[model samples]
Target: MIGDSNRKMQQIPPLKSIQAFEQVARFGNVAKAAEQLNLTPSAVSHQIANLEALIGRALFVREARGMSLTPAGEQYQREISGILQSLALATERAGSAVGFDCLRLHAAPSFGLLWLLPRLDHFRSCHPEIQINLSCSYETLHFGRHQIDVDIRHGYPDWPSLEVRTIRHERATVLASPSLLERIPVSQPSDLLGQNLILSEAALVQWPQWFAQQGVALPQAPFALGFDRSYMSLEAARHGFGFALESSLLSQDYVKRGDLVPVFPAELSTPVSAHHLVFPRGHAEMSRVRHFLEWVQGQLGHVFNY
Candidate 1:
């Protein structure tokens, strides 16, 4: 590349000349190439003329209306076009590697608002380089038309060919405000018989399923409160309205602040593999995806006691 006489004879053309030649060959007009390259038409034509002189071959056939590529120019264009595209792609990737990387994330509504959003400050503070685009919706796990890099789902998804890791394992137990417990004392699971039970209508694991797992025959009495979303049910339980069976992981901040307390013993608590981080297989291999996955794993790897 530096000193060999044979290599010196094969000197590479100036990048600008090659750029102008490619644009003109594709557009078949000096003015369009000049506009695209943000250079004067005369400048573009000068670059092309210089390139033709250096190559010892006329690259374009001059015409009254517009130019057309010669046989040599057609061959050169075919070769150089792919190289230019590759160069552009490489430049974009290099820029992203430095700091401009963005991660597109989608999460379930309640988990996004009540759990993930609360802890994003810590993640951002550490990795200021990575930008996160967070979206939340109740209808998740379907990547159909959305361009999501990662999905924060709840429960064991049977989605084949997807990389699913359970980020947070939780203890699903009775959660109630201190005032509510003081009003109706519950020493055993059977004591919840006639008590106000706040139910999450769309929850995967509901009170009926909890009782079925506990081998407790539930009464046919109507629930005291019903909500389709967990946040609302949790909020209602925090107001001393009724007992809400919720995951300890999602209600961690509330438990830490003593807004809600576990009403049942640890033995009665059901282990749920909840709060999964799902993505297409091998997606975590990317630096941006890996950063998020590693951050989440590090944050939730420890057990939070009730």
Candidate 2:
């Protein structure tokens, strides 16, 4: 019995190999997986090879187009993915248990940078006993599978089986640098027709919606500069590139700093959507999660009157 147990333990693959395989399985491209793991393509291939040897199965089917998981690979992924995440959480908790509490939080890229990051110092000062591991991504993660404590998502509250709350009402408003607005006068929504509009890919409200709300007509195929994230749009607005439609709450800091100013005197805000705090059901009972949730709500409410 002792010899059998020793042999079984020796068969286990290295953690690095498993991590590399998991990333490759999810991404379906070694280069993409390598980028995520900060490893080279050859190194990722080596790890995958090592893992396959340990399991005695081909984990991935290499193809001309891209890689696809084999049946065994898929089965292995489904079994081990959640386990790996749980292991990570356990490891983090072990460290926290020794000293301070730990909270694993995720947020959308722009919101993390423009909004949450600015106020994290305040949270740290208030909750000195808790350690926060904050991650930013545009892709929606499986809250339970990824073991995320809280996710700050910008969209309708439609995530099934999750406790969702509207943390901040995202008011879409037109903003531009004071210098830019001065050079190209924009007294009314219609005045913005001929001006360069900085478009954000993540914008919940578009130019047409804003124009329609103001009872103004939109030009067909209007010329505009596009960015993938809100932070980029805000930066463009600051540099006097063009007017951008974004969250009033997100732009508040910029507005206060005089980097950007509201386009219209009337606070024309779009009511299409808002920011929601999402977590797995029953997680609100956790002290760390609840504390952060309440604190963020108060902070955002003060910033944007949500």
Candidate 3:
């Protein structure tokens, strides 16, 4: 009698068929569900049919326009949605524990260069069980389609449907080689007029913007040099090329090592700009994403507030 009961339980619909029904219910169309599942429409329809046969009832009402869930299908979906979510979470946790999970992180190029890459060694050392893959890009990446677990971007809070955490509030200041400072002393913003002004695309506030913020109009266009990255401008400044306005957080290491000296005592606080970590709305709870987020927050605790 127990064996018969076990055999009957084994006759339940496959998980894939249930998944197909769920996706179809979500999109209300086989084609759209197929696209998400990476299967053909016919396959999605076939799966739903198989599922319906197992339940001894039609799950979806076939229509000329598309498909709609039957009342039974809607009820089933309501019940199974939470089950699938829990199963997925459990599977992810298991995969991460077994070292089979790979966390993908995307970051702005400048942040990746000056901030994340420098500190990733400690993260890797502590969490040797988890693997990390990092990609740097200037373009905005969406969390869902891009499969990005975390994205570190330099911007204000504007992205929608993503969890945004401010990693650092940026303040820009003029920095230069000590030797260059010896040649040209800056007492006020106006004194920067004749000096070489290095501008970087990656800067939260550039030379022009910083000067304007300081309430000093450049009497003349200073001899300007432009670089595509903030690090490049800092490198040029280290070689005594010119003065560069840089974020204090990015220049902390250089300042400590005496590679760059502040040309001015004044700092231009950027009220509307900051470094933020973004994640898909629901992904933050996943073990892999949660681990990385906690590690990063801990590493930058001094620099960032929750």
Q: After superposition, how far is residue 30 of candidate 1 from its true place, in Å?
A: 45
Per-residue lDDT for 44-143 in model 2, tens only? 9999999999889999999988799999997787566444655766676787556577788899888889888998999999898888889999778865
**Ten contiguous residues with the weakest lDDT in model 2:** 297-306
Could you arrange the candidates by lDDT from highest to lowest? 2, 1, 3
Across residues 1-306, which tens digit of lDDT does each residue of candidate 3 receive? 999999899777787887788778767899998998899999998998888888888888889988888888877775554345456546666766455667788988878888788888898888776688899987886343455778888766775335688866557778899999888877787887877888877666666676677798854764578888777888898999988877777777788899998876644444435688876556677787888888877876653443
- Candidate 3 residue 158 Cα shift, in angstroms, is 1.2
Q: Roughly what TM-score does model 1 have, to 2 decimal places? A: 0.66
Model 1 has how many clashing residue pairs? 0
* TM-score per model over all chains: 0.66, 0.68, 0.67
Q: Whole-model Cα lDDT per candidate?
A: 0.80, 0.80, 0.76
After superposition, the stretches of candidate 2 with alpha carbons farther than 4 Å from their true spots are 1-96, 302-306
Number of the predicted model whose lDDT against the real structure is largest = 2
Q: What lDDT score is found at residue 29 in candidate 2?
A: 96
Worst window of 10 by summed lDDT in candidate 3: 265-274
Best by TM-score: 2
**lDDT computed for candidate 2:** 0.80
